[model samples]
Target chain A: MTDITALSEEQILEKLLGGNEIVFEQVFNKYHSSMQSVAYAIAGPIIADEVVQEAWVSALKALPKFEGRSSLKSWLIRIVANEAKTRRRKENRSVSLEAIQDSWSTDPRFSENSQWKNPSSQWHGDTPEELLSAEELKNCIEKSMLKLPENQLAALRLRDSGGLSMDELCNILEVSSSNVRVLLHRARDKVLKVIDHFQITGEC
Target chain B: MLPNCKQMAELASKNLDTPLTGMAWLKRKIHMLMCKHCSRYSDQIKLSSKTVSTLDLDLPINEDVKKNVEKTYQELHCRKDVSQ
Candidate 1:
């Protein structure tokens, strides 16, 4: 079996254009999740799969004209993001940034003077790998992530998992850079809190 | 002015996406030197961010959708070949 992961971008493009089924499957498996994440972030869960399917169709149709301007993964992600946005508009579902509450102002971790009222305790696991080793903690994190506000979840998914640039994130989420930062921060903070609680108590 | 603990927490999260620089960077460093709690908080957020990035959140693609996409690809490829 050829190592598709080892192939260069140009090589992958060639294989894809040549209609290599194996390469196509490999590529699909590699990016399908990230594409779905972007789609879910924009279009919501109900139509996210539909948006990704549409994105794949569009990407395949336009594959011949791919100029290699951005990475193949990035191009595909942008396609899904656009498809999800259009679908969202059609469904009359707007992801309102204003709906996100600014919890930082009233966070319980800090004191009235902005000092640490309840500081974080030492964790048994320091690295991400170590923390994720516990299956329950992983589930807890995922659950917390799913419960985050729509825009915040979208920002985190795009920036962290999708590996999109800040500019791309702003463009996709249709928010200012500062607003993107807030969304990203809130999402990450929730994850941090989840892990912290899990570490301290060993329960979800 | 030095950023308080709340501001430091925000900076730490922002630093993960875009590195803090100039005064912000210097201030975070200075504050970390004095406040162990904020330092730990920053480190924890960084760890969580790393974990989130590494998560495999991809739900499996439906088999029917997979087949349809493959079929569409083949039809497109044939059309291109005929045109060439």
Candidate 2:
């Protein structure tokens, strides 16, 4: 059994194609969660796993032609994203533009002037180490993240957590680069407000 | 002209993704130097975004799924190898 953790893209590709079960398993575990997130974003949670499964099959078939143009992870994620989009279209589920717009306008946090009506309070003990150490706060942040509007959550997940570039985000979400920037800003603002509220009141 | 606190906050959030450039960049720096609230908001939001990104929210892929994928891959590849 090969320890595929430290392998480069070229090496990993070679081992995976060489019928190494351990290498295959390691690769699957490494990316399944991120792919699941992309799938869920595009197709919703019910069929997210199905989309990921299909993506794996698609990637496996296309492996022989997998050019090293992009990192292996990026290539695989793009496949998952596209697969999920196809599934979403088939299911006839789409996020309405009106919903996204309404959420932005009716956001109670902002004033008519688009400034924070009740500006965010300073957070206490919010260092990265402190954040990780505060299990309750961590849980609070995660819950708030889940509650965010779908598009905002998806944008945040792909850019920040999935480590995708803005260009890739624009391509996946079918939006322009400036739109991607605004989406990310709005997403981060919502998350920050959650943290602020949590810090001030000790409630999520 | 320099941006106000409201606009400053938005710019600060945007700055996380892309740097402020040209005159707007200079203005933001000067404004943050003077406005304590916006400065704190800027710092806190950057920290908040970083912390939130580090949160483990990915949907779990359990052992069953992994095993299934592995088995499927092997079957597909093995068949292909034999055919070729």
Candidate 3:
């Protein structure tokens, strides 16, 4: 028995295409949430799981022809992204392509001179990584993430959590590089604000 | 030109996508040294981006769903092998 865990993903893909269930299952469990997040952002929560499942079926079909262009995770994510967009169209859901300019312009965090009106307090945690592992903070960040605009949420998830490149993000989101950057910044800013608020009040 | 806190925040956010260029990088750095708020904001955003990237969303696959999907794949693979 080939220890599926011992091999790299490329090796796993080789076995996976040759009918290794172990490799397939390992990769599936590892990537399902990321695939689902991409789908959820593009297709909404109602059918995100369906889209991910469908994408897997599609991935299986295309496994033989899978070229090693991108990493396996990214390739699967692209497939899920495509599936989500198609599903979105079928469901008649439209994503707004408007530039993400409004919130930044009127942000109450800064004054007319663009200086801090209310400077953020230092977080209690020593490091951001430490802060991320806290259950209360995670709850708050997750809640704040949901409240973000669809485009921003998708951009943030794909770029940050999904480990996709800016070029890939622009292609997936169908926006310019500048827009993708803005969307990501906006999304991150909201979460940062949430953490700042949480630290000061001890509430999410 | 020296950037204000709002501009600093904007630059900090954009910095995640691409590092600031020569003049822009210098201005932001100088401002960050001079202003505690902007410096804190920069640290917060950088930390935010790092932490957020590693965060797993709330969704977790159920054991039943995973088993069913694995079963379905196995069956399909078995059929393909038999047919081939």
Q: Highest TM-score, which number?
A: 1
Q: Mind giving the per-residue lDDT tens digits that candidate 1 earns over A43-62?
A: 99988888889999999999
Q: DockQ scores for all the models shown?
A: 0.60, 0.47, 0.56
Model 2, span B8-75: residue lDDT tens: 87788788878879998999999989878888889987897788656756467766666777877897
lDDT for position A3 in model 2: 81
lDDT of 2 at A61: 88
Candidate 2, residue A28: the lDDT equals 83
lDDT of 2 at B2: 81
TM-score of chain A of 1: 0.86
Which regions of candidate 2 fall more than 4 Å away from where they truly are? A1-20, A63-73, A102-117, A124-129, B58-65, B76-84
Provide the overall lDDT of each model, using Cα atoms, as 2-decimal numbers: 0.85, 0.77, 0.81
Decreasing DockQ order of the candidates: 1, 3, 2
The i-RMS of every model, in angstroms, reads 2.2, 3.4, 2.7
Residue A203 of model 3: what lDDT?
A: 89
User: Could you tell me every candidate's TM-score relative to the true structure?
Assistant: 0.88, 0.80, 0.83
Candidate 2: pairs in clash: none
What order do candidates take by TM-score, descending? 1, 3, 2
How would you order the candidates by lDDT, starting with the best?
1, 3, 2
Q: Chain B, model 3, TM-score against the native?
A: 0.72
Model 3 agreement with the true structure over B56-81: per-residue lDDT tens digits: 67777756657666776786663564
- Cα miss at A133, model 3 (Å)? 3.5
